[model samples]
Target: MLALSHYNSSASPLFPHFSNDSAGKLEARVTVEGVTDQPNFSPGQPTTGGVIVVILSMTLGIISNIVALIILANAYSLQRRRTKATFLLFASSLVVTDFIGHVIPGALVLRLYLSGGVHHEDSNSSDRMCQFLGGSMVFFGLCPLFMGCAMAAERCLGVTKPLLHSSLVTKTRTKICLCVIWLAALCVAMLPCFQLGSYTYQDPGTWCFIKVLSDTEEVDVAFVVLFSGLGLTSLAVALVCNTISGLTLVLARLRRKPGSHHSAKSHDIEMVVQLVGIMVTSCICWSPLLIFGLMTVIHSYTRSIGDDLLQYQTLMVMGVRLATWNQILDPWVYILLRRTVLRKIYLITKCQAGLRGNMLGRWEPTSFPSSEKNEVNQV
Candidate 1:
């Protein structure tokens, strides 16, 4: 049976620290006894299994995000069209942020878990690392969220206000909007760092989570609530706007004539589809975590049924999983939006020597006139 003394000593400082050692020990003994008496009380550690899962998840996520970034960058470099370039630039920004969010922290978490110690040696270092990690999470995560919304808004304007859009949504305007998104995201993320000390690092035996709130009221709860709410609200608004615009475009296409310029219509449909996909994916990945986080904040203020701690932890873990999956799937959106990208891939494959012979292979032979063919043969 696990002793209460050990558990209490190791309890995260972010939570209410129990000072009565005797009482804690007594409670711990009772809890351990009760668990041992139960039929389903298997208390063995699952470190090996957890570590393996972390390693595989981190490795796969890294590889997938790298591939996504490469695909987007390559696509961006190949395109010359203004609209296509704008989409690629937006996609590239998203990919870069997603890469940092998935790869860096993931690797750090794995290392911390495997070593059974944090990378930060002292309290100050730990605090700094915590703030750094927390800030990075907020910055990178929010960038794509806002950029995506801007992309949607631009698309909507392009469709609904074609004449105005031609003048308003110029390359300069797009770049400015993107710049604003990054600045806004950074400002929102760093606000917490200034007021609250670094996020407390807690090892829950399975995964790492930031401890924004401390046991003492050292940080203003209001600031945390306000900033987090603002960030989430912005992301939610973007997602809704994007989804609406995408659906409108799709419906308009459906209502159009069958003989409409098929190529142009198809391209428009593809762009809308890609925007819708990105918006839906972002919402799916982020909403659960945001909702659960809000609930946690509310519960903290009320000091109510702390019994739901386990459930809250589970939800947070699920949220992390959703966020990480975003990195893996981002590449498909780039491919769907960019035509020059597809052409380049085809060209690259065509240049390969062995790939030339097959009829449906990468390369095709040029046809000559019969007269030319005969003259060449006669020579």
Candidate 2:
């Protein structure tokens, strides 16, 4: 139990303070400042429940991400097609991002727990760690959503217009696009440093994030809205692109025009299925947190002071837990849902159908045409 009651009046190292603390232009303060008055300030005691959950989530996420990366690397090496290689490269990058997301933030949380929660002293060193942790959360959290959207768009183009895709999209261009996605996420994460919004330690002192309901309600609302809006938009784009790709593939399969390459069609189907799985996983796992963020900000906008503090805290914690699951479940989408797996399933189903037909033939009399009867007798 660290206990010290001291206040400081210096500019936040992580972000700048507003020159004028007007109603609209409020200061963007980082949560690590030990400001007891702030809504997001840590209570200085680490909850056993929060610690246990973080440990379990971190452990599973790290192991899963590592295995997914290994699987992706093997696939990438085996791929003969440049298009496939590019997709694999994007997949490998997403896994690496998730892996780091778990390792870096998890390590920080563990360190905070071991140190007995937030320090009493308001020092530069303490602020730096919190800033790093918050920034890591933002960067890693957004990368998967953005990456999924990009993958969906790429596959949609490839399936809908192969000639255009081949002519315009290349390995170099894909790599550059990936870098741009990463850069965009990094920029959003660093926005707090520019005083657009602020990062603060959340309840139980286990994690840090954008301040949801702060004194500077306008800035807080804007930042939260920005983060959540980006996530929702990415998910929406992924949804549309995947739907178009899936429909295109289904239509192509239905038509089955002469001279169409079965192998290529199968490849497109597999890719689209995998992309859909990713899109669904992202929506299920991340929507809660993103939506919760939007709601929280909206609620803050409507109400200056919160009436149900406990409820808000509980919801935030639950939202964070759900969002963390995205990384853990993402890799398995590719591992389990693949062309080889689907082929095996199809074979089993076909065998079962054949066996049932044979059993029925032995139990019930069946009539055949004279030509079929003659053919059977000849055989």
RMSD of each: 10.5, 10.9
Q: At residue 16, what lDDT does model 2 achieve? A: 33
**Tens digits of per-residue lDDT for model 2 on 256-305?**
64333466565676778888888898898789888877776676566533
Q: How does model 2 score by TM-score?
A: 0.78
Q: Runs in model 2 with CA error above 4 Å? A: 1-38, 41-52, 119-126, 257-261, 350-379
User: What lDDT is reached at residue 51 by model 2?
Assistant: 61
Question: Clashes in model 1: which pairs?
Answer: none
